[model samples]
Target: MALRLLLDSADPSAWAEWLPTGLFRGVTTNPTLLRRAAQPCNLEHLAELTARALELGAEELHLQAWGADLLGCGRALAQLAPGRIWVKLPITRAGAAAARALIAEGCPVTFTACYEPAQVLLAVALGADYIAPYLGRISDLGRDGHANLTRMQRIVESVRRVDPDGPGDRPDASPPLRLLVASLRSPNDLALLAAEGLDTFTISPDIATALFAVEPTLAAAAQFERDAEDT
Candidate 1:
């Protein structure tokens, strides 16, 4: 299956054309993106944006929580944009607790700002639906981002093997916990991770375009077309 691509666009206008590409499985928005778009940090606004994204064919919508109060934020998030929404919480103690509660209530939660394998493990333990690790940020800190992701992949596999009946033993175990690689700096990062069998990636529109521009991908498409024509 094609690796699921999520568009990380701040400005809705910036994604107007990209949305029609039909390459994205979801959209992710955060405070920084909202600030760039000059949007308010309110549930109403978030719900509206999420609805709009859904209308544009986003299967999942990610909205980040701002304040330090996880319970309050989770409660509010649980009520906003009910369908196909993943409330993004930071990797904190309060956030984990809130995520656990929300997951138990059947609300999807995306644990963000994960920097270590331990963080991902904690999110999984809390029954999070997704985990967003900042790959570019880790690289900026002079760490090997791919290595970290590989480590996370291994840890996830190990856990699944030990406890096949664990919280993440859903039907789609291939994309376990929806490993959403965020903080992408370039298109190559997306391709590299996708090739590495990472589950999902959230990338800026510019990076998305660059990734779609890869020569090998285009060649493969052309070959498929040629074969279809011949047949």
Candidate 2:
């Protein structure tokens, strides 16, 4: 599959800045991001936020469910934009239960906070739409984050071979569980992880900006403009 990028932020300003670029497939948000953006965690605020994201050209929105009643929150988030919303749940027992129920009800689910390779099995078995692993956070724990993420991607690819209509093979079939890697620290991490065969990513605005900050590239663009102006 081709590389898919999602803007990881609750701030509409970020969405407005990047979404219109047509590079990001969507936007991903959790309670912490909402808090960081000074947005309320309640459904009322999320409804407004979702509308704003869509207005800014976000094709999809991954809204995370919080608190004890994950299923309830997932259901509400799913209703926000119907096919456009993908409810995010933690990859825990409770989250699995919630994801199972949500998936059963036809709500696309993304299992989040995935720290171990074994957790990918849960997402696969449950037929989730996506599983997110925090790469930089894993590295912060003194583990080899790139190696662990590659293992997770391998598990995701291995599952595709079992079914005739699995990920990256059939376009009309049910979507397979995708490894949406998150918590990227630098622009270089994109190339590093992509080299490991990982595709989907959720990046912060700073990283997004850095992706276009190469000095040589900027100089080339300036020279092109100067040539055009000279003509």
Candidate 3:
């Protein structure tokens, strides 16, 4: 499968125009993003945004829950988009319990705010659909971000070998839960994670534009055009 590209935008109004550009595979929003949009973080607004994403052909919609009230959040999520939504919760015990419950009930859950490989292992144990690690946040704190992701990948593989029916179960031989690297600061960050075989990466439009703006890339394209004309 192609590496999924999700746009982490705060404004819904911006998405209506941006979705047509064909770069984004999905959209992810948090309470902060909604606050930036000048909207309340309620179920109604979330459902509306989810519907808009669906209309824009987004394959997934990531919605976050801020506190320890996972049951309430899960209920609210069920009401707002149901199967189409991936409820994002922190990588805490409460979050894991809620994620397990939701996933058992067939609701996709994304375990967010992950920092360590242990957190990712817990997410897999809870049958999470996605585990989001903040690469930039980790790197900012003087940690080797890619090393952590690599460690998590190894843990996943080991789990699969020990007990195939355990946290790393491959029901149809599919890989374990996807690792979605978050908190991207630049297009280079996305490229770094993509090269590491990450399942997905969320980026801002500014960074997304930068991915195709490297001077060497432009020069190579220009050289190709000149060579074609000569031929």
Per-residue CA lDDT of candidate 1, range 4-54, in tens?
778887677756767778888878888888998898778888777776777
Best by lDDT: 2
The models' CA-based lDDT, in order, is 0.80, 0.92, 0.78
Order the candidate numbers by TM-score, best to worst: 2, 1, 3
Cα lDDT of model 3 by residue, 102-152, tens digit:
777778888888898888778767778788888888988899987777777
Model 3 C-alpha lDDT versus the unseen true structure: 0.78
Q: 1-231 in candidate 2: lDDT tens per residue? A: 888999999998888888999999999999999999999999999999999999988889999998889999899899999999999999999999999899888888999999999999989889898999999999999999999999999888887877666544677655877899999999888899999899899999999989899999999999999999999
Worst 10 residues of 3 by lDDT: 167-176
TM-score of each: 0.86, 0.94, 0.85
TM-score of 2: 0.94
Q: What's the CA error at residue 141 for candidate 2, in Å?
A: 0.8
Worst 10 residues of 1 by lDDT: 167-176
On the 0 to 100 scale, the lDDT of residue 67 in model 1 is: 85
TM-score preference between candidates 1 and 2, better one: 2
**What TM value does model 1 have?**
0.86
Q: Lowest-lDDT window of 10 residues in candidate 2?
A: 165-174
Ordered list by lDDT, greatest first: 2, 1, 3
